[model samples]
Target: MTCPLIQKDLANACALETVKKIVAEIGDGIFCVLVDESGDCSNKEHMVVVVRFIDGRGFVVERFIRIVHVPNISATGLKKALETLLSGLGLCISKIRGQGYDGASNMRGHLGCLKTLIKKREPQAYYVHCFAHQPLLALVSIARNHEDVDWFFCEINRLVTFIRSFNKRQDLLCKKQVSHFADLIENELMETGTWLNQELSIARANDTLWGSYFRILTRLVWLFTPIVELLEDLNSD
Candidate 1:
């Protein structure tokens, strides 16, 4: 029997086919790349590549090209990886208008960084400090310099850690959210359903970095009542 997991060759073929359609639609148009690298739980390094461009209809679009696994994380290695990726996507490096990476010293190095290397290859490609990371850097500076704000965040983070610590609590929380929604539906107090037959409108804006796990706890606190009620219902069930 065939295994349930996707075979590498087939998956790569399918991914290439999708990227082929995206490039065909983009068609020699100028575009910018947003690149970021992260380490996975398995200790493997992966790079996420996203492209932003204007389509034929004058509408802006952003699409993920792929997450590539690189054997090495050096500047030279990453630059080579990018070259191979663009070639595989059937896109010319000269058509690249911009590049973005995090505020890391290695990435933004004046001499041999990926930004400098790409610029050498295509002079028109401007290197941008990832706009989303700007606010994050600001916040980091604030947290370090400020005492009260840091303490407040630390307390909230502890609370969030407690909430997410156990699977039993998580399941109970989901149950409560469901029960609360049902209660609202039963009382005819809220419309719980809607249908969209046409295209969905998406906001075109520079998405900034939003703070991390703290938002999860903030949301949980806001929805605490319904969550409590749902958990009670689950217990009685």
Candidate 2:
């Protein structure tokens, strides 16, 4: 099928008109804005901003209204890009009811420059830190403070890497039901901390163990003889 003749400028103008018409028809509704920045293979940073709002029927819809190629991740650059995008959409920063972003240092801050500017403009705008990011930050904190825990994670990762790298080792581990056993072990391990006399320390130790349990189980099952010998040698020591 032959493609129809299309003019780029006319296409963009019509698209913008459609968006304006839709927003006008929707009337007043809470708008959720999401902003994020990413770097491409060429190492050029681009900022994308999206707006979501509810319609008359109370159904929520999201629209990608602006994508600006920012020079950098500086506060001034982000502010300029966001301001320009909002102005072009005939949106006041104050109209935004909710905001979401990947918890970048620039995006999720209260004292940092970006959030300060945003709060100054919209005092009631709700700010949410991405949930997935919060857990990752918590994990990183735990990993940083405990040397033995960090070592266990590094070793577990190395074991997983080794198994995944070799087709035979992965197949053997799967045949031994290591994955399923690891899942069961983790469930049991969670219960272990609840009845401990030294609850807090035991829980922390169990948390580290649970985190790396699967890798250790897979390694043990796949390399059973070596693991048994290592355990025996440790006992003799």
Candidate 3:
């Protein structure tokens, strides 16, 4: 049961059955596609494909199609990969009424992009920049335009980098957290209960995704005193 090969086989079978059902559900219907590509932890580029359409019950449904490993992420290469995937699933490119992708040059470029290529093949396959990423992009733009906001984020990044730079510093942080929590419990400032006093680590803000700034700010507020003490201890040493 723990064999890697057997596990892979089982996963593949499950994916196949799931995709078959999705394709059946999308049968003879005009659908929209959403595509996104990113590098995995192993640094391999994989593109995710999802099909969205209204079902017989008149409810909109979105289904995962497959993840395709693409060695080349050029617009032409991605278009070919998408074409082959849809063909294998017996889905026609002409039936694609919409294309949703990020604003990456290779994806939404005016010329020689996945959007343009698809539009050329099927003129009705209109493209739209994905709505999910709009808030993050807007926030980043506003930060750049506002000097104070940008500076605050920069200082936060520097603080996280300095603390996470050395193993000894991290160890000191952990010790400070334990001591602080113990004091809180002793003073009845914090409750003593199961799962109440879990340890926390500082989170660094990520530029590409939403809520990352909020996470890092929340963590900083929670551990502000410990972080300041750690910095002072390092300065004295």
Candidate 4:
């Protein structure tokens, strides 16, 4: 336990065992693959591969199979990296029933794209743009075309940043929420139960995720009174 190398070896062993179990569950069944590449904090490109298939209980399951370093993001480079990863895992590319990738030019381009290259090998591997990105793309388009929506988002961003800049302000917000909830509970305006009226904090929005935007807006509405009180106190100070 005191040795770092030993710890790393143990972790690797656990990971390999988990992958082996997942492969046994798959049992030569067709699976859909989702592949995406992004740069790490050190500016190194890495590609993640996930496999989706139905389990013995007939429930849809998705497992992260590997994250391989890809020095190149070109169509051919990505395809080669993918093939190597799948083959190493003892998986056949021909068994792929679906391919999911983000709407990147190198991925879904009309000619000489990753999808095109994969199709040449396995015609049944139908390509679908990642659904998680659809709402993000829609929100981005709306923000560009509409002035009011874009301005609202900007103001929200400023408000969240201002509040989160100071540790004292965050503590004040949490204290105010506690007091407000107490009042509601005493007056029977709110019900108390297991997992009810959980504590909430401000969520920062992300440029690539629509769910983060929704969360911040929802928290803003839920904690409106405490937020307003916080701003008023700051103004007085």
Task: Report every candidate's CA lDDT.
Answer: 0.74, 0.64, 0.90, 0.90
| Candidate structures ordered by TM-score, highest first | 3, 4, 1, 2
Q: What would the TM-score be for candidate 3 when compared with the true structure?
A: 0.66
* lDDT winner between candidates 1 and 2: 1
| Residues 104-151, model 2: lDDT tens digits | 667766466566667677877777765545676677677758999778
Model 2's TM-score against the true structure: 0.52
Candidate 1 RMSD to the real structure: 10.9
lDDT of 1 by residue, 1-237 (tens): 265465776887888888988899889789998888878999998888999899999999988999999888878888888889988888888899999998555577877888988898899999889877888777666775789966765665564454467666666666666666577668986565565111111111122334443455556564667556644665698
* lDDT of residue 155 for candidate 4: 92
> Which prediction has the highest TM-score against the true structure?
3
- Candidate 4 lDDT by residue in tens digits, 1-237: 879999999999999999988888887899999999989999999999999999999999999987899999999999999999888888888899999998788888889999999999999999988988887887788785798988898899999999899899899999999988899899999999999999998867875677788899999998998899989988999
Model 3 agreement with the true structure over 1-237: per-residue lDDT tens digits: 899999999999999999999999999899999999889999999899999999989999889899999998999989999999999999998999999999888999878999999999999999888988888888799887899988988899999999998889999999998898898889999888888878888767765676788888888887888898998898999
Candidate 3, residue 163: the lDDT equals: 91
Backbone clash pairs for candidate 1 read: 176-230
In model 1, what is the error at residue 171, expressed in angstroms?
34
Clashing pairs in 4: none
Clashes of each: 1, 0, 0, 0
* Better candidate number, 2 or 3, judged by lDDT: 3
Question: Which is the better candidate, 2 or 4, if ranked by lDDT?
Answer: 4
> lDDT of model 3 at residue 208?
62
